[model samples]
Target: MNVTIVGGGVAGTLTANYLATRLRDEVRRKEIEITLISDRDKLLYEPGLLYLIFNRLEEKDILRDLKILLDPGVKFVFKRADKIDLENREIRLGDEKLSYDYLVIATGSRIVPEEIPGLTKTGHWFYNLDGAVRLRDEIAKFKGGKIVVSVMGVPHKCPVAPIEVTFLLHDFLKIHGIRKSSEIIYTYPINRVFLMESVSELVQNLFTEKGIETRTFFNPIEVDAEKREVLTLEGERERFDLLISIPPHKGSKVIIDSGISDDGWVPTDRYTLKVKGHDNAFAIGDTTDLPVSKAGSVAHFQAEVVAENISAEIKGLPPTARYFGKAMCFIETSFNEATYIWFDYETQPKFVKPNKFTHWMKIAYNRMFWLTARGVL
Candidate 1:
């Protein structure tokens, strides 16, 4: 039987790798053809982009070739998926169609800059590789001003990123001898800084101690680029010299138009990663409607469960593997220190003390990204 996985991202790559190395061996005892489809031939290691901004990592080092990432038993198809036909068990890639017995949708999220008026034309975003590079260049030239960093909406990949950016900006400005002159503001609609109360309190205290202003429940309604002003839904206005905006995100049109997603995200069994309303379909990574944080660590755990279920189905056995919604995130506070948070659906996040070791773990993750991208992890 052929298993076709769409989107050569963390979810797709890890799921296919685990299925081939462990699950297929215990069940099928024979090679089950695995095909991975995506628009690009490389897997981007995104977590390291923060280090890349400070010339700590090279751009070439942040990518791994997809051709080498898959196992010998897996076929790599570098093409943009047009649609997923669940009824016909086919995936359309432009003019071509690939038949599949099982399918995995990990196409990830899309940034809609147009959703926030003037954001696309005036403000800046740094979610992807290209945007990160542009923002790096723009930041290098900025000496000092009101640097506003914010999230545009919910369900954004790596929710802690905007806060990390704010902290990093603090360090960046200090290095440029403009820390006192620059005003950093972080605004978000969430009542708390993070999902957990303890973590939120810690982050809030850090922001307060650092002299960075924090604004909660301030949903940005409009941006006046000419005047460097931000108008919020609460009838409040804030001015900034440089606006760093995280535009609204949505599921890929391919997933939505294919009827696999609701409200721009694939609805799935939270524990199984199986797409709801479809038996032979599953989703992982940033594309799924999982209750946990959308981070690479969560995707890795979800992929394991998904692979087991797929393998169990092939063996005519009940799928016993289940996801526990585990996710861990390393919040970069400064170049010297970072904090870790571990959480699951049943428990609130508990903060781990920051030390030199935490900083080293962040550094080691850079290497893990390379190995995972190559499907070895």
Candidate 2:
């Protein structure tokens, strides 16, 4: 049987590794073959990019060769997955085809900043590596002014990121002796700062303690580059010297174009992780429209469930494994202090208090990610 996975990102790579390790004999004996397809040769550790702006990590340190994920029985194809002919059980690479007995769509999500008028032209962000580097330069040059860190849309990956960025900026500016002169504002469409009630309360207190202003229900409609202001749907205007935006995001082009996704994200059974209406197919990570935060930890949890289900099927057993819709995220408060949150569909996020050791755990995660890809940790 040929089990093909699309994408080499966190979702795809981890799923491949878990399955390979789980079905060692099946893969080794050629009873099942695992093939992973990637559009890029390198995997960017996105969570580490935030630290890049503060000089905690270098560019090379945040990226890893995708080739390192491949073991003896696993194969990788470096090509753009243009489409999937689900009816024919084949994936189309331009005009070529790769047949598959089981498929995992882990193409992930993408940011579409240009969707908002002048967003790309006026605002800056640290969501990507290049953006982090560019923003670092701009931030270092900023002596004093209003800095706005905002969420342009809902359901973005890691809802706490903008909050994290603001806290880090406060510390960074204080270190440079510009904290008093600078105004830090955080805005989002929702009234709360985070999904978890307790976590939201914690973040609200943190915002107040750090002297960062919070603005809610500011549903952004457009960004005015020349005017240095954001116009909201409610006719309110917020101005800033530098705008750090969490732009609009959607699923990948292939997932959208393949017609598997409704509005760029495919729907899946929350517990089973199976793509709705497709018994032999599943979608994981940011590519699936699940009622959970789209973070790497969520992807990691989803991958384990998907791999387990596939392994069960190969062994002529039913899929007993289930996903609980729970995920954990570490919020970087400053250079050496951090906190974490854990939430699921049933429970409110009740996190541990912020401390130094939790911060180090986050730092260690940057390296542990590689071990996971290499199938050792």
**Highest lDDT against the true fold, candidate:** 2
Q: Which lDDT tens digits does candidate 1 get at residues 223-336?
A: 888887888888878898888887788877888888776656888888878788788999888888777777888888888888888878887889998888889899988878
Best-performing candidate as measured by TM-score? 2
Candidate 2 clashing pairs, residues 3+ apart or interchain: none
Residue-level error in angstroms, candidate 2, position 236: 1.4
Q: What are the models' TM-scores?
A: 0.95, 0.97
Deviation in Å, model 2, residue 122 alpha carbon: 1.5
Q: Please give me the total number of clashing residue pairs in predicted model 1.
A: 0
Structural RMSD, model 1: 1.9
The candidate 1 region of ten consecutive residues with least summed lDDT is 22-31
Q: How many backbone clashes are present in model 2?
A: 0
Q: Flag regions of model 2 displaced more than 4 Å.
A: none
C-alpha lDDT (0 to 100) for residue 345 of candidate 1: 78
